[model samples]
Target: MIWVHLLIVLAAIFLGARYGSIAIGAAGGLGVILLGATGAPVSREDIPFDVIGIIMSVIAAIAAMQAAGGMDWLVALTDRLLRKKPKRITLLAPIVTYLLTLFAGTGHTAFAALPVITEVAKENDIRPSRPLSIAVVASQMAITASPISAAVVFMASVVEPLGVGYLTLLAIAIPSTFLATVATSFLANMLGKPLSSDPVYLERKEQGLIELRGAHEYEERPGAKRSVLIFLIAIIAVVTYAALISENLNIISDPTLPRTEAIMSIMLAAAMAITVLCRIDPSEILGMQTFRSGMSACVCVLGVAWLGTTFVSTHMEAITAFAGSALTAYPWLLAVVLFFAAALLYSQAATTKALMPTAIALGASPIAAIAAFPAVSALFVLPTYPTLLAAVEMDDTGSTRVGRAIFNHPFMIPGIVNIALAVGLGFLFGSLML
Candidate 1:
């Protein structure tokens, strides 16, 4: 069953679904068949329907934001802010991307910021690849810092029973992850100069590929500033509400309040505010077509996750036993093991659900496991990530492939450093139980 799960994941990546629906469907079907054939207890109810809801809602909200041009507005704002200096642009790009990931709870937000970063990079004669790489790495790093992120949420649930406090774990993970992102951006900036001066960038420059042609049209809208102000306020409120709820002070209390509920509330509220301020219909903001399209995009992730869960549940005992023995012999290898597992799994939430419990059962400290969470969670930055593929397709630039080829350029280096720094910092700060 474990091998089946891995094979399904590999197939999904290789086959490359347009929206991930086919891959997910295939994986889910196979999981059910294999589980039943093995006489493992399987039921429809065992499926993580709540997770599916959360994924759908978040994707929908992002779609709504995009359709309403909210994303463009935000990008324009970022562009204005970073237009003064190349060095400032370099610093601000990663910081903004990281903040977006923290607030949006997904790397998609960071990817959305890429165009703005790339444009700024072009304007400044800086390598677009450097800022693009920074944006990608920043998003991955922020996944560990984002309390509302699926990875952090899943890890919190798994490690809480083992005596690790959520805030403490986040405290240890956030700074290290942030620093790793900054370090990656700096190093990439140094190395990417040569590549930026290569024929490709020069050709693109001659073709006017990187020029900001529509800046004036976008900035000319009358109420743009007011609409953007409202949007910013709404986002701030959403973040505050999420933090309050997580801290046990908000309206929602049920640990199982379904992450979707919180996210949807924010989405709806933001949509309403934007509509009222801009005098546009809410439905028009995120047309039925766009909503459906976003949902379709997430289907693959949902299916793959469900199938992966089923596969793990079916082979739980054997896999757990084997993992336990292995970890017992080399406990220090936990960070590396999780990093590789995450790279394979792609979905941090799914990876956490699959392996975290087993880590606890293996007598690993909650802190150790939680500290390792960032490493595994960062795997979503892989070029095969569904959101990443979409971003790559959107840009029509081979940056994603190029980025992947230069593994140390962005995702890989930052991911590795995040793990190493997080584990080391956790131990130094006494956040690690051992």
Candidate 2:
């Protein structure tokens, strides 16, 4: 029965991979139905509504900011910083994207920075793949560290009762992932041939196909800075509140609103504030690309997490019986498992909600789980991911092209290095901190 049920989960992932976008969530919903029809126990309690709520609220605030031109403001700032040190774009690009994701709580923000990274690399005659590869990976990994990201939020919930809180999780996740990303930049710098000497680039240049059309000058909108300031203040408020009420602090005991609920309220309030203060139309927020992408992500989390949690709940006993001892003995294997599952799940929040609870039940310690949390950023394994494909497409020099062998792409090596080193550093940090 477990094997049969596992096939259904795999089939859902396959359908998601084939169809793309919201189909991933729809396929997951179908998997849930299949599980119930096949006599597997299904429970409504398995649905991760809290995780969904957190993601939706965060997305709303971010979308509101985007509608007000705040994202453009941020990109323009990063662009200026990158141009100052063109020769170090490989090291700087990922750092820029990483910080963007950290603030926005979504890797999709990397799209706004990708064009700039490519242009900087091209201007310096450096291979665009060097910066682009690590930039995409860094953006993905940053979700685990982002204070408001659904993945980190869900992780804090699971670990809080076990003596780890939100701030503690950030303490371990941020430094570990950030430093690993910086180290991987060196590896990314050496990934492919120099832009001038690469055969594909040379051919493209000979064919007059290599156009170095730089990004346009970005004019700040009337309310862009104000919107960004409002959103940043909201984020600070969320973090400050969470820290005060955390188990470690116990400063706000028995509060009527729990941490998750507080986050939703604060973000929704921030969205309203942005709409009113920025004088932006509410409908325009709905039309923003970030809103559409984010809402779609909410659906994906809903369906995939529901499907995964249902299956895991029904087979909890069997799963624990089969893999519990091994995991208990080699806790690091938990990170390895999460790394591959994330590749299939295609969502850090969904993967965390689905697996972390079960890991805790099987005797995995809080530190072990926290150390492994960064592994869920392995969304680059397949080339079909939006940001990964965007990196490949935005590079006109042909230096960032994907190979016929799907795994042979430029992002693979750098992404793998980042995740591996992050997991290692996570353990080191977790041991020292917690």
Candidate 3:
């Protein structure tokens, strides 16, 4: 019966993978019905409404920021920083992209910087794949580090009972992911033949396909500066409030609200403030790219997380009995599981919400679980993700591309190295926090 339940879960994962993106969530709910038919009905307890609310609210604020041209303002600042040191873009590009996504709490922010990284690499005669690959990976890896990311929020809820605080998670995640990104840049720089000597690149050049497009002259929209500042202030407010109310601080004398509710309120307020103060049409936010991706993320988290919870909740006791001692002895194996789960799910937040609960329930320590958090960034294993596809598209040099094998894309090696190192660094840093 457990095996049958597991098979149902696998089939749902397969169907979600086939359906792609937000469809996974829909496929997940169907899987639940299948689970019920197989004599395992998911109760209301299996659903994760809190996680969904947090994702939607965060996305709303992000969408409002995009509609307000705050994202454009940040991109413009990134462009200036990159041009100041074209020679070091191999290292610098990932830093820029990493910080953008880290602060923005979503990898979509990397899109603004991908074009800039590719162009700089091209101007310096560096292979666009180097910076482009690591930059995209960096953007994603930063999500695990971001205090406001849905993945981190989910992780905090899972591990708080295990004695981990939000700030501790951030402290370990930030340095660990940053060091991994830096190491990935070195590996990325060595990938493929030199740009000038690469035959495919030369062929593309002969076809007059690769052009050294100059820097873009960005004209700021009205209130762009003010909007970005307001958004930043909102972020600072969120972080500060979280810090004060954290278990370590205990600054809240009388607390009636869960952190999830607080986060939702703060973000929704930020979105509304951006809409009103920026004087942008509230309707415009719904049309922004960030809004669409965010909504997709919300749906993805809803379905996949609910499905995952159902499967795990049904089988958790058997799993705990079977793998408990082994996992308790070798908790790092949990990170391996997280990496592959995220690879299949293609969503950090969904993957986190779905799997972390079972692991924590099974006795994975807060330290081990938090250390493994970086592995949730494994969306790069498949090239189908938006950032990976965007990196491929933005590169005009033909240097950045997917291989004959579906997973043989340029991001594969660097992304793999990045996740592996991040997990290792996470363990290292996590030891101190523990």
Candidate 4:
């Protein structure tokens, strides 16, 4: 019966991948039904309502900002900065995308920067693949580092009771992941041939298919800067409140609002503030791309996390008996498992909510689990990720094309290096701090 139920779960994931988008989550719902039918005990509480709620609230605020032209304003700043030093784009592009995701708590922000990275790379005769690949990788990787990201927030909740506080987790994650991102950018710089010498680029140039469009022109929005400032202030408030309530500080002893609850309410409040202060239409937020993608992500987290938690909870004892000692003996193995599961789950938050508790329950060290948190950013193993695909399509130099072998694409090597290096750095920092 267990084997049969597992097969049903795998099949649902396969079907979801085929359907794409919100359907992937819908498929998880179907798997839940099948599991219950097969005699697996299922509970309503397994739905991860908090995780979904955090995603929704964060997305709402980001979407509100986007509707107020804040996203365009941010992208325009990055574009101007990149053009100033096109020769160093390979090194700087990932930093830009990473910062965007870190602030927005969603990698989808990378979409707006892809064209700018490509154009700047071409203008300087640099290979677009170099910057574009690392930029996409960095965007996704930054999720684990972002303070408001569902993955990190959920992870903080998981480890807080085990003697790790929110600030400690952030202290380790932010620096380790940022340094790894910088290191990977340097490595990605040398991966492919120079844009001028690449056969495919040369062919495209000769055929008049390649266009060297200069820097993108973004119309300045009157409220763009104001919206960005409002959003940044909100983020600071979230972090500050979390710190005050943290176990280490205990400034807000026995506070009525928990950190998770604070994040959700603060973000929703921020959304309302942005809407009112920026004079953004509430209806416009519903139509914003950030809102749409974020809602879809909410659905995905709902279904997939529900299904995963149900299975793990039902079979916790057997799972612990089988793998607990192995994990305890090799703590770093947890990072390896997260790295692969993230590739399959396609969501760092979903993967973390699904697996991190099991690791904690199995007696894996808190520091080890926190260190392994960055491994969930391994969304790049599959080229089908939206940011990865967008990078490929945006590069006109033909330097970022995916090979016939799907995993043999531009994102694979740099992404793997980024995750691997981040994990190593996590352990290094985890040791020093914890």
Candidate 5:
């Protein structure tokens, strides 16, 4: 069954939606059947409903932001900033991604920022892949550092029984993740020189894919500045509130108070207030297609979470038993093993939930596990991630392909090295056992 799960995830990575869905669905079906036959406590009632709610609310908020053209506006803003200097653009791209992911608690926010990062890279004659790589890597790094991210929240929950403080784990993770990002960017730039002169670059340049066009239509709308400001304020308020609640800072801790509910309430209120204040019609804000798209995202998230939960529950005893023995025999193998495991799974959240508890049971440090989070999370850099696919489609230059030409393209090699550097630094920072 474990092997079946692994194969399904790998097949998903290779064949994408059509095959990936079949593979995952089949594996999940088999797991359920086997569990039922064995009389395992694999009831669907055990599914993580809170996780489903979080996913749906997040999708809704992102959809709303997209409909409001905030994403497009952000791209234009990045273009304006990066048009001045390649060096500054190079430095700022990852920094901006890190900040966004820290606040938003979703890599999708960083992924949304990619088009802007790519645009800036184009404007400066820098490879769009360069900034895109940085954006993705930085986003993964932020998951470990962010107190509000799913990985952090999940880790906090799992490690609580191990006598680990969430803040203490976070303090260790932040420095390690930050160092890893810097090292990754530096190493990637060094190895990716040949990619700059690749034929795809020349072709993209000729096709004007690298050129900035007339002002984006969204930027010229009436009261755009005010709307943007309001949106930013709303985002800031949400982050501040999340932090306050997570830390229990001077606020009564309501054990029943759901974080997702709080987040959704804040986002909805902000979105409504900003729309009315800017005199934007609700219909216009939602657009014609936003609802369906948002619903699709919600469904996907829910299905994936349910599938992951089902898989975990069915295999819980076997996985825990194996992890206990394995860790006792080979402690240092945990980091590398988990890295490739997550790469195969293509989902840090799923991998963390499935494996982190087992690792904690085997006496892994919460701080060490937290530090290792980024390394496992970075595994999604494989061309399999939907956002990476979107970026590739948008470019259409084959520049983002994993290994069509040389292994050292801006997107390919840098992403690989980024993961390696992150893992290496995790060990160096005492985040992982060597």
Candidate 6:
């Protein structure tokens, strides 16, 4: 029966991956129904309502910023930063991508910067693959670092009953992921040949496969800077409020509202402020690229989390027995297993919510789990992720590429390196902090 149920869940994931984002959620719902009919216990509380709220609120605020041209202004700034330091872009691009995901709470923000990094690197005779690969990895890694990110929010809640809190998780995630990105950037710099000397790029150049070059261009809307300033101010406020309320400081008194409420209200109110002050039409928020991508993420998280939670919760005994015995002997393998799972699930929130709870029940230490939190960013192990795909599309020089073999993409090394440093440092930091 357990094997049968597992097969159904896997089939749903396969269908979701095959059809694309929203299909995953639909398939998850179908799986839930199939499980219950087969006498597997299903609970309503298994749904990640808090994670959903966090994602919707953050994405709503991001969409509002996008509608107000804040994303454009930020992207335009990133373009200038890359062009001005083209020689150093291989190092700086990952930092830029990391910060973009850290603040924005979604790696999709890196889409705007991917082409610019590739182009700048190519023009400077640096291999575009170097920056493009690491930049994408940094972007995904930042999701674990972002305070309001669904993954972080979900992680905080999972470990909360064991005494971990929001800022504690952030403490472990931020510095670790940032350091990982830096290390990954250094190594990614050495990959492939200089753009002018590369066989692939040179052949493409000779074959006229290289697209015509132009300076990165984005027309700054009238209120772009103001909108960006307001959005950033809102982000600062969210982080500040989270810090005050989180376990790190415990400065804020118990309020009528939960931190999730604080986040939702702050983001919605900020969106309103941005809409009015930046002269953005509120309806336009729903039409922005960020808005659509965010909604799609919501569905993916919904389907995947629900399916994963249901399976783990229903089969807790079998899961606990197997995982507890194995993890007791080799605790660090938790991150290793999650890294591989994330490579398939391709979602930080979904993977964390689905598996972390079971790990906790299996006697996994909070500190160990916290230290290994960044391993969930391993989706870039495969080149199918959106940011990875976008990086490939943006590299007109043919330098950034998936090799002939399936797992031989340019992103593989950076993804592994970033996750490795993050997990290793997570253990180091988790010891000190937790």
Task: List per-prediction Cα lDDT, in the order shown.
Answer: 0.59, 0.91, 0.84, 0.90, 0.57, 0.83
- Ranking the candidates on lDDT from highest down gives 2, 4, 3, 6, 1, 5
Local accuracy of candidate 1 as per-residue lDDT tens digits, 60-127: 55545555566666676676766756566656777888877776666667655666666666555665
Candidate 4 wrong stretches, greater than 4 Å: none
Worst lDDT 10-window in candidate 4: 212-221
lDDT of 3 by residue, 1-434 (tens): 98887787778877877767777778888888888898886787777777778778888888888888888888888778888888788899999989988788888888878888888789889999988988999999999988788788878878877778888888999999999999889888888889999898999999999888788668888868877787788788878888888888989856676677888898899899888888999899899988888788777777777777787777777888987887699999988999898887778987888888878778888778888888888888877788888889989888888888888888888888998899888888888778
Score every model by TM-score: 0.78, 0.98, 0.96, 0.98, 0.77, 0.95
Give lDDT tens digits, candidate 6, residues 1-434: 78998998888877776676577778888888888888888887888877888888888888888887788778778888888888888799999989989988888898888877777776777788888888889999999989778888778888888888787788888999999889878898888877778787878888887764668668888777887787688888888888887766878768576777777788888888888898988889989877888888888888778888898888888877777978867778899979977876768998998898888878888887887788898988766788888888888787778887868988898888889889899999988987
Q: Look at candidate 2 and tell me the lDDT of residue 79.
A: 85
Better of 1 and 4 by lDDT: 4
Model 4 Cα lDDT, one tens digit per residue, 97-201: 999999988998898899899998888889999999999999999999999999999999899888889999999999999999999999999999988899999
Scored against the true structure, residue 216 in model 2 reaches a CA lDDT of 49
Give one digit per residue, the lDDT tens place, for model 2 in 60-116. Answer: 998999989999999898889988989989899999999989998888889889999
Q: Residue-wise lDDT of candidate 5 within 1-434, one digit each (tens)?
A: 56675444344434433344234334444544554454455566645455445444544454455555655666566656655565666567777777776755566666556666665555555655666666676776677676555566666677655655455556566777766666666654544434358786777768866546433344555545555566567567655655555543525365355555665666566567656665666676555243444444344433444455555666767777777676656555566666765654455555566567667766666545654566667444355555565566655444555665433334555555665666566556654422
Alpha-carbon lDDT of model 2: 0.91
Pick the winner on TM-score between candidates 4 and 5.
4
Question: Number of the top candidate by lDDT?
Answer: 2
lDDT of 1: 0.59
**Total backbone clashes of model 4?**
0
Give lDDT for model 5: 0.57
Judge candidate 6 at residue 327 and give its lDDT.
81
TM-score of 3: 0.96
Which sequence of candidate numbers ranks them by TM-score, best first? 2, 4, 3, 6, 1, 5
